[model samples]
Target: MTSVPDERFPLPEGFGPGSVWADRTGHRTLVGRTQRGVEIPIGHGEGEVNPGELLKLALIGCAGMSSDVNLSRRLGDDFAMRLWAHGTSDEADNRYLSIAEEVQLPLEGLTEKEIATVVKVFGRAVAAGCTVERSVVPGIEVTHRVLGAETDAPEEQA
Candidate 1:
């Protein structure tokens, strides 16, 4: 249960992000820890999920969170819903090309107009509010550095 970054990917501090601690648990598997103490399993079918799947989850998770308020206002304060994200990997590019999100919302008793309004509101809310989606849409830059490995501070500075 270890994804020991071989000589191939050398960073010593896990992937490029400063937010996750991807400690190898086994071959191709790592447990990503966040500052909040949440642990996310990561791997290529090794852990709970892979990186690409995580990205899709991020997108849909953001979408649902963003639409929460709007949905509650119209669909009742206790509306129920489930979200899903799907994408296929592009082996040549080593990334997912496009991801699609689906939501199973309980629009049971609402009229056609109400359902339409709810859908529109949810769509607009997600488009304007999901920061994760926004960031992924244009792509963001990720710069990383190996901390504590830079250089020893002088005794006085330390």
Candidate 2:
């Protein structure tokens, strides 16, 4: 099968908070200026996928894309895909500590064994390649500390 043209995909040159550019087709491009800015693409989905929700979707997309790319190389263009992702995050601070997602692979013609293998391979691809998935995984340790004493007093003491 014919492969995706190298020209179709290229890495971005300069990217940081507030960086901006437009493609040859004139599509607008904006670089995140901050953590909040980092997720600007999420707004495109509006109510369906809020800005924060898009962040979750972005993770899924990243993983899904990685899997699809690998699968395509092996299975070619005949395979079709439909991906849906949903998860929760802390809007108060924009911290994401937990997430759950489902990936469906339908092989109308392939055998059950093929489907099982696809799931296994896809899971590995998602786990290994998805930035968000890797971030959520348990191996990474996080530590938080307060530089000074807590400022807020108990409501009863106040």
Candidate 3:
């Protein structure tokens, strides 16, 4: 992947709440950890969530959680639902061009009108409350600076 600096991107003030970091544990592998002791396996290996999957989940997962209140008001509190997110990658840019989500739920016993209302409510709730979705829609600045680099290292510094 290649990167180009965009000065228009905002420079964030400080780290957000909580501590999150990753450690190299193997070849092309990393173990991401949270301040609360949650460990997420991140790598290209055939295991758990990698970086790309994590990004997609952040989008769909936020939608599901935010829409839960509206969906539960229409469907029962215990209604079953499944959400999946996929991204269309732009190979030339090495980034996702777009993302689409498919939500499956038990809509049996409800009228056609009621079903439509439920779907509309779900969408509206997500649009209003899903932070990740809102951020991606308008785009957000993501800046990276490699830590532990020496001034006299092999590569040039920014």
| Model 3 lDDT at residue 133 | 73
Models 1 onward score TM values of: 0.72, 0.51, 0.74
User: What lDDT does each candidate get?
Assistant: 0.66, 0.48, 0.66
Candidate 3 error regions (>4 Å): 1-16, 140-158
Runs in model 1 lying further than 4 Å from the true structure? 1-18, 45-47, 139-158
Model 2 alpha-carbon drift over 4 Å, by segment: 1-49, 73-75, 89-97, 139-158
Worst 10 residues of 1 by lDDT: 149-158
- lDDT tens per residue, model 1, 2-103: 333336456554455345567788898988876556788888773488888788888878878998998899878898878777678779987666665667
For model 1, name the residue pairs that clash: 1-25, 1-26, 2-25, 2-26, 2-27, 3-26
Clashes of each: 6, 1, 0
Task: Encode model 3's per-residue lDDT on 32-143: one tens digit a residue.
Answer: 8665667789997778677879988887788789889888987889988777776656789888766667677787777767766766676677777888777776553221
Q: Deviation in angstroms for 148 in model 1?
A: 53
Query: Candidate 3: TM-score?
Result: 0.74
The window of 10 residues in a row where model 3 has the poorest summed lDDT is 149-158
Sorting all predicted structures by lDDT, with the top scorer first, yields 1, 3, 2
Q: lDDT at 38 for candidate 2?
A: 28
**Residue 53: error of model 3 in Å?**
0.7
